[model samples]
Target chain A: MVINVKNLVKRYGDLIALDHFNLEVQEGEILGLLGPNGSGKTTAINCILSLLKYDKGTIEIFDQPMSPDAYDIKRDVGIVMQNVAVFEELTVYENIDYFCGLYIADRQTRKKRVAEAIDFVGLNDFIKFFPKKLSGGLLRRLNIACGIAHQPKLIILDEPTVAVDPQSRNNILEGIQKLNRQGATIIYTSHYMEEVEQIASRIAIMDKGKIIAMGTNEELKKKIKSGEHINLELLNPEDLDLEAIKALPHIISAELTDHQLVVKSGRDKNNLIAILDHLKDQNIAIGKIYSEPPTLNDVFLEITGKELRD
Target chain B: MQVYKAFFRIIQKNRSQIAIYLVVFMVLALLLTNAYTPPQDTDFTKTRFNIAFINEDGDSELVDGLKTYLGENANLVDLPDDPQQLQDALFFRQVVYILRVPKGFTAAMLNGQEVQLEKTIVPDSPSNIYMDLLINKYLNSAQTYFAYLPGLSQDQLVDYLKVDLAEETAVTVISGSSHSANAEKSGYYFNYISYSLFAILILGVCSVMLVFNDTDLKRRNLCSPIRSATMNFQMILGNLSFAVLTWLVLISASFVMYGSYMFTTNGLLLLLNSFIFTLAALSISYLIGNLVKSRGAMSAVANVFALGTSFLSGVFVPQELLGANVLTIASFTPTYWYVKANNEIANAVSFNAGNLQSIFTSMVLVLAFGVAVLGVTLVLIKQRRVEA
Candidate 1:
């Protein structure tokens, strides 16, 4: 395991930020921590990094105990905070150089890394620009560049794409994948399920400061009863029997609205075929048919009884 | 080392603001030195006044002796015995003093009878007091000789009085030199430094510290591999080096302005006092930097603390001239002790243990303030760490 957090419990006065939180990140894999705001993702990350004082539990990194003074462990870890953290007085190149210098005492090596970081973030043209002069997306890019310039073994990014524009968001997401390919174990946290589903090899769904479910995309989808959604445009909707469609095998719910028949089914491969056969038997002519696979939101809703965004 | 380098980079960015304070203080110190410096020439000359001697009594040896003595110190003017002419002469300042011998005859004084001389003079003139002293000296001497030496004739008595009064005491005037002038100038320069040093340190050190203490930036730094102790040491090194550099600049400027005096014992003490004060100011800046949240609050704190302490202490005004109550309140500020030490060093006549005791005491007080404030800042940092 690259990072292991066992039975971690952190509290802020009467509020429990993390309750028996346990996580184990394998080497060379992207573990996406998916949750809404205030789901103890950040608190757990802080505890794992030893940046916070936990009420109870232990965190081990690289098979060694983690602590505030764990310099050896800290040397291999990089963090990109939720907020942009860079010196406003320093230019882009200078900010990257300063952060890189903290880890790499060698001047020449630091110079090369800083340049690479600038190029990696596509900030070469604005290397001399101060953070205040940059747009929001460019500033977030600069923030990431400062964190990853040192090329640590484990990189943790907390909501790195929050408030970012679509173009910059794609650039950042692509850059994260490239960093992962560079043989660094990564722990990515975000509330956007699509982001986690897109890049995360394994997803951990968190709610109320605990992981409600943990699995790969396919495995997590299998944990829920929702399989797929089927929608059929009806030409003769007045003749359609909604109660009969609900009575069909593997059909969990069925509804008809605006001359379209929408049906939700359990985990069964032949649910769509059965629905289509019933429609044909009833002589109900279907104009168009659409089938959609279950999303991460569906898995979240099935397990948590609420939307992932909620 | 990276943090240390960044600290100076921030200070370099603020060099323009610091330069403005330096130039303003230098100009002010120069102007004040010029305005208060005395003239170079130190020659002495006796003051002479115009007077009229009226002889109301008949010509006698006694009257003649009095007239001759008065004529030596004053320019005896010729005036009519008429009252209107005498009044006009006195009013017009043509004669600042007038002496009239009464018609008592010579026997009144030979018989040891107390006879008064009538005189009229301008009222409230500085020369009037000197004239009175001269007259009293001559008459009192003559009376004593007549009473004690009754055997001597009037001519002999008058002659003896003249001989006795003719003997004058030698007077010497100490010429003011450039050393004392420079000392005074240096005193003013160092006293004014209290304000500039406080302002610059607060603005520069606090500004840099504010960046380092930023919540996001601090968290980022903590997450780095650098040890917290090493980071703190680098920060202290940066703040100390900046403060010392500022003090060196101000001290060097003093040497340029007031050449040889800055090397004197008193001047060296002034330098020591200011160095101590610089440390105190740095501690204060650290406190304010940690307490404040924004640049606007930093500016306000810098102005209020620097200008307020300077005015209440003796930076803009002399401590001697400050009210008792005001000094009582100002005694709490480090600047007050700093200016007090500077004043003591300037006025010191000898570099003896007794003389330097108060100066060292004041310097120690300033140092104590720095130490005390640093303690408070450390406690605050610890409390904040716990809270975080």
Candidate 2:
């Protein structure tokens, strides 16, 4: 285990931000922490990193006490927060070099890492630019480059893709995966469930001040009764077809709008095949069909109330 | 090494204004008190005027005698005008005094009727004192013709004085005293400006707001390996370097310009005096910078303290002439001591060791105030977040 946080408790006056939050990150797994706003994700991170003084907690990283002086342990952790962090006086390259210099001792090796990190984030062209001069997306990329330039063993990313363009977002997601592939353990946090489902091997769904659920994507989805989904693209399906699909024995709920009907069911949600069979028997045809497995959102909504944003 | 590097970078950005500060101090010093004749022993060569015109009489009998007397005094502005013009010259301080004749004055004096002489001046200007001695000398020498003559009426005596003698001297004396007092009055601007540098030094103005701004970005550099405390130390070092650099340049230039006379045996005394002033400035600056949260608050407090101290300490105005009971309260201000020290040193007034001790004591008090502010700032900013 690379990171171990146990029995962590934090309070701000009368309000608790983190309560007995327990989490562990194995050496090479990408653990995504998913939560709504003010769900103690930030507080947990602060406590784990020892940035904040928690009321009661023992955050042990690499199996030792963490402190401002824990150079050897801190040297292996890289964090890209939701907000950007770089000195305004420093240029993009300088900022990356500065953070990287904190870890890597060899100048030549550090230089190579910085160059590769910049290129990894598609920021080679903006290496000379300052943070203030870059667009928001470009600045986010710069922020990522600064964090990962040192190439630590564990990288913590907190909503790195928020408000970014599609291209930049895709690049960042791919880069994060690449960082993981390089044998780095990653702790990622984001409100976007699908992104977590795609990238994280282990997901922790947190709420209030504690992690209410934690599991692999497949296992988490298994927690929900629904199994599979067949999305149909049909313009103006006949009311009889929709009625027949609803009349199926396993069907739980069916929503029809915008020239499509989504039929939902229990564990064997393949009421899709039966509905199609009935549709065919009625001489009806479907345009495009997509069959997908249950996603992290289903798992998340099943575990907690479906409030997307806090 | 890291600390030094941080300080160097900060100094780099403010190099422009640093030069300006030095120049301002230098120029102000040059303009204020370069008159180096040991103010007490003013060699009368610098004096521009002298007295005596034998205004013996308008009668033909005394004309040749008066002309002969005028030929001898090189300092005299010739008195060829009528009584009014002669009197006007004396009133303007162009001549000290004039002897004027009543019509038939020689006949009256010879007939033993009467004759009168004229004089014009403020009592403090001492024009009449000199005139009195000269008149007696001449009267004893030229014969006692007008010895018993009643003097001219104050106004009529100097009718040639523009707007009348009493009228002109009143305004002139008031104006002259105001200028002299202002010109010679103590000032604390130097010390206050110095104190401001101390605040900038301790907090490191270049990085003060920058650190506050960097708090977010989520886990940014703050989560990086470097500790925030080390970063803060670097910033403090940088700011201190800039402040010290500013102080050295400003004080050196001030001395090179207005304070070169401090090189006179009394020079060290002047410098020691000015040193307190500088300390006072540095202390106040630190106090204001640390005590206030916002720049506007800092600036407001800075202005109030700097300007208020300058005025109250009698930097721009003389405390003695300002004549406020509150001045005793103001005198307790650090700036008050600083300017007071400078004034005492520059004037021929004797310097008591006790006075210097008190001035130094005030400087230390100002320094104490600065340290107190620094402590408060350190506490307020201890957590390394945006200060509330």
Candidate 3:
């Protein structure tokens, strides 16, 4: 394991921000740290990074204890905070050089690293421009560039794609995958389920400062009661025919809306032949047909109750 | 990349704050003219005289003739019915000098006997100085007429005395004053005052704003990988840079008003004064900046405290007029020390260890303030990192 955090607890005055949160990230694996707003995602990350003091916990990175003077551990850690944290007086090129200089002490090495970082983010056109001149997409890109300019072995990104253009988002996702392919472990956190589905290998759903569920994509999909959904546009059918449709084997539920028949079924839902035979017997006119497998969104919705949380 | 970006981001974010800064500066520039302009009470700088002639003789010749001699030069009030009342007026600052002629004063001058008139004066008043000068000038003229009388007839002698002593003194003194720029000698230090107030405002704004801004941003930067020491050191340098820039601009503006000789002779002294000024500015900025947590709240706190410091430190009014207790309290503010040093330096006839020491005292106080603020910021940074 590259990072291990055990039973972390944190409080602010009378309110608790984290409650016995535990997490682990193995080498070379991309773990999606998923949560809604204020669900202790930031608190957990802060505790793990030692940016916050916790009441009780053990946090180790690379199996070594972390502290203020732990240059050995800090030298390899890069952080991109939620807010854009760059100096206004400095240009894009200088911003990258400063963060890279924090690590990679050698002048020649740092210079090359910063250049490669700018090239990696494709920000060469704005190398001389100030941060205020950059757009939202470019600012997010700059945030990322400043983070990975040092090229740490383990990267933790917190909502790195928030408020970015689709094109820039795609570019960032591609870059992240490329970095992983180069053997760097990554921790990704986001509220967007589609992004996680596209990039994450392992998913951990968090709520109330605890990991509620953890599994591979397929494993998490199997954990939920929701199944593949099939829908078909149907002509008018008698009320007695609905009874026969309910009798179809492996059909967990059926609903009709705007002359459309929607049915939820089991994992191995190939037993839809009976329902189709009944539909044909009724001479129901079918216009269109479509089906979709269970997604990570379904897994999260099922595990975390459908109630708003701060 | 991080360093440069951080620098640029700060500059961009501060743009509006700087606009507000310059606006406040503009208002200060306009309103500060009140400090240098002379107080419009009365013409106290001019030698004013009240001449009272007591014509007790049946013949008004002596008093009438004396009136032409003395009254032409002085502001002749009808010789007061009561001499004691006129003397009281002089004591109460209503008149500069009072000339009292005895009942026989005019008869003696007409009889060609030596006429002695009593002039009443109040020694404790500022007008006494002008009054003495005018009296000396009058004496010299009277003596000249007596010396030249042997050459002329009595009528010519009276004519000469009236023309030279009374009428001519009026013309020469008044015209001499109007000839050159009427530089009022009273409150001459006031121009230094306007210059000093302008300089204080510069220090006040730049220092307070810089300290409050950095201390606020430190909360955010503390969580980042960059050390608290680095962040604070950079902030102090940045604020110091801004304070110095503002001080330079203020000094330049004052020099433009004071003129070319002022710029050449005192430019370096003003520049040196900036160091002390900035030291005080930084110290004050740090103290006031760290007093609060939120940036919005810090602005209010800094402005109120900075303005209070300016008022107590004699930036607008003289500390002496503000009284001894106020100065004792003002001694605690570095602005007071800095302004005091600037006065001592600019007005000094020669540069000596004493002059140097007084000027440097302010610098030392500023240094102490800087160190204290820096130390507190570091501790707070570390403490907050853990608290987070």
On TM-score, the leading prediction is 1
Comparing candidate 1 with candidate 2, which one achieves the higher DockQ?
1
Estimate every model's Cα lDDT from 0 to 1: 0.87, 0.63, 0.65
lDDT at residue A114 of model 3 (Cα atoms): 90
Between candidates 2 and 3, the TM-score winner: 2
* Segments of candidate 3 deviating more than 4 angstroms: A12-15, A67-71, A83-91, A104-107, A128-135, A225-227, A237-248, A305-310, B1-224, B245-274, B286-308, B323-329, B344-367
lDDT of 2 by residue, A1-310 (tens): 7889888888988898897999988999999999888888877887777678888878888788876557678888998877777766668887788778767768899999999998888888888887889988898888888788888898988899889988878788888999999988999998888788779999999887899889898777778877776677664465445666777877766777776766667775557668778777876657887777767666666777575454
iRMSD in angstroms, per model: 1.7, 4.4, 4.4
Q: What is every candidate's alpha-carbon RMSD to the true fold?
A: 5.7, 10.6, 8.3
Q: List the lowest-lDDT window of 10 residues for candidate 2 chain A.
A: A235-244
Off by over 4 Å in 2: A13-15, A67-72, A101-116, A119-122, A241-244, A282-285, A307-310, B1-207, B210-214, B217-229, B262-305, B319-334, B348-356, B383-388
Candidate 1 local lDDT, B343-376, one digit each (tens): 8898886788886888899988999999899889
Q: After superposition, how far is residue A137 of candidate 2 from its true place, in Å?
A: 2.3
- Which of the predicted structures, 1 or 2, would earn the higher lDDT when compared with the native? 1
lDDT of 1 by residue, A188-227 (tens): 9999998898889999999888999999999999998878
Across B1-388, the per-residue lDDT of candidate 3 in tens digits comes to: 3333343355455657655665565455545543445424423344546644444554554345555655545576653557688777666756666655567754454445776666666777565565455545554554556565535544665566565654432323332231111122111222233334333433343334343345323323443456656655665565556566555655565555444434433445655665555665655555454455465665566556656776887766665578888888888766677556655555554677887777677667755755776577567645655544
Q: CA lDDT of A280 in candidate 2?
A: 77
Better of 1 and 3 by lDDT: 1
